[model samples]
Target chain A: AQSVTQLDSQVPVFEEAPVELRCNYSSSVSVYLFWYVQYPNQGLQLLLKYLSGSTLVESINGFEAEFNKSQTSFHLRKPSVHISDTAEYFCAVTISGGYNKLIFGAGTRLAVHP
Target chain B: GAGVSQSPSNKVTEKGKDVELRCDPISGHTALYWYRQSLGQGLEFLIYFQGNSAPDKSGLPSDRFSAERTGGSVSTLTIQRTQQEDSAVYLCASSLLAANPLTNEQFFGPGTRLTVL
Candidate 1:
């Protein structure tokens, strides 16, 4: 079985400050990693994904994550965050060749203050 | 194009009662999925349906939980004899199920929040 673990339940940072949300996974087989963001009262939207090729994947919103196979981790990072960046982030994983059912971690709430 | 949509954004039902949550996936999407979000469980996959193939019920918590996708577009998650533990947000997502799994992005609905009294 595959599982995801978000080290932090909540992260508080000031606007314009850098932030990193830690995520680690345990899987017996190769897996694909993803980050999904959920704004308050909104549905979750895909942030970015690491499927193949480069180990580092980035989203349009200046957020990036690197897949570290040795560490079994995919941590999301933002150089500088905005007030609007406050949302819940989830780390998900699925077997590379298996069906599309996603195994998600307990989300991390990002609270960006002014 | 419109995204995934779910009905009865908020539902309040008594314990031991039954409830049905509906999901309308994006048109032409061949794959649909049901997930539950709660304080205890976070987000968990409950069921999955792909095209005309047999649905996957491996993620269901118990026999009281069931789901069906008709015509490969609309899906309904039925919870019979609901309990307080069943009070959670039911989320539905759909994907195109492309030949490349990397391209198959799942779009989520606003979700139906169910409260059991």
Candidate 2:
């Protein structure tokens, strides 16, 4: 079975500060990694995904994540965050060619302070 | 285009009662999925439906929880004899295809928050 672990339950950062949300997964076979962001009282939206090719995937919102095959990690990073960036971020994984059911982590609450 | 939508944004039911949560996936989406988000379980997949194929019920927690997708567009997740443990937000997502990751990006609904009293 595949599983995902989000190392931080909560991440606090000041506005314009860098932030990194750690995520690790345990899967025997190849997998697809994704980051979903949920703003206050809103549904989750796809932030970015690492399917193939580039190990470093980026979202249009200036957030990026590097898929480290050796470490089995896909950590999300942002050079500088804004107050609007405060949200709950989730890390998810699914088998490369298997069913589309996603295995999600516990989620990390990103509290960007002004 | 409109995204996935879920009905009864919030549901309050008593224990031992039954409840039904509805999900309306994006039109033309071939794949739909149900997931539960709770304090204890976080987020867990409950069921999956793809086109006309057999629905996957492997992720269901127990027999009390059942779901069905009709016409490949709308889905209903029925929880019979609900318990306090069943109190959580039920989320629904849909994608164009279930096979290819390049094009299969799941779009989620606002979710139905269920509270068992």
Candidate 3:
């Protein structure tokens, strides 16, 4: 079984400031990690995912997450955040032969203030 | 082309009433999924369908919850004698294939917010 844990419930940062939303997961075998963002009253959109190869993955919106196998973590980060970056972020995991089931964490609400 | 779409964006009903939520997967996508999001359970996978068949229903909370896909495109999730605990945003998503789990990106729907009173 695979599971995710988001360390923060809410993260508030000033505009143009760097922020990190922490996520940790546990699984017996190799797993895929994904980060998804949901804006107010909208569905979740994929920010990025880590399957293989490079441990670092980036999104077009300047958000990046690094998969640290040793730590069993995939924490999302942004060097600089815009007010529009405020949204709910979710970390999800799916292990091999799990029938495409993704177990997600409780999510962290990111709020960027000006 | 349209992304995944769900019907009844918002629903309100008294406890013990039955409800059905609908979903239409993206064109040419062969895999579809259902999820529930709430303050308590967070986001949990309810089920997934490959084509018109559902091979995994392990995520369904109880026997009261069931889903069916028809014509290999649309699906409807039915909750019998809906309880207050069932009140949550029901989400739908679709992917290209069930195999090669890593490459399949599930496109999500806006979700139907069910409110039980």
Model 3 alpha-carbon drift over 4 Å, by segment = none
Point out where model 1 deviates above 4 Å.
Answer: none
Docking class of 2: high
Interface RMSD of 1: 1.5
Q: How do the predictions measure up, each by TM-score? A: 0.98, 0.98, 0.98
Worst 10 residues of 1 chain A by lDDT: A93-102
How far is B94's C-alpha from truth in model 3 (Å)?
0.3
lDDT (Cα) of model 2: 0.94
lDDT of 3 by residue, A7-60 (tens): 999999999999999999999999999999999988999999998899999999
lDDT of 1 by residue, A1-114 (tens): 999999999999999999999999999999999999999999999999999899999999999999999999999999999999999999999887767788999999999999
* Backbone clashes counted, model 3: 0
lDDT per residue for candidate 1 within B1-117, as digits (tens), equals 999999989999999999999999999999888999999999999988887454578989999998888887888889999999999999999998833586679999999999999
Model 2 per-residue lDDT tens digits across residues A2-109: 999999999999999999999999999999999999999999999999999989999999999999999999999999999999999999999988767899999999
Q: How accurate is candidate 3 locally (lDDT)?
A: 0.94
Off by over 4 Å in 2: none
Q: Choose the strongest candidate by DockQ.
A: 2
lDDT of 2 by residue, B1-32 (tens): 99999999999999999999999999999999
- iRMS of candidate 3, one decimal? 1.3
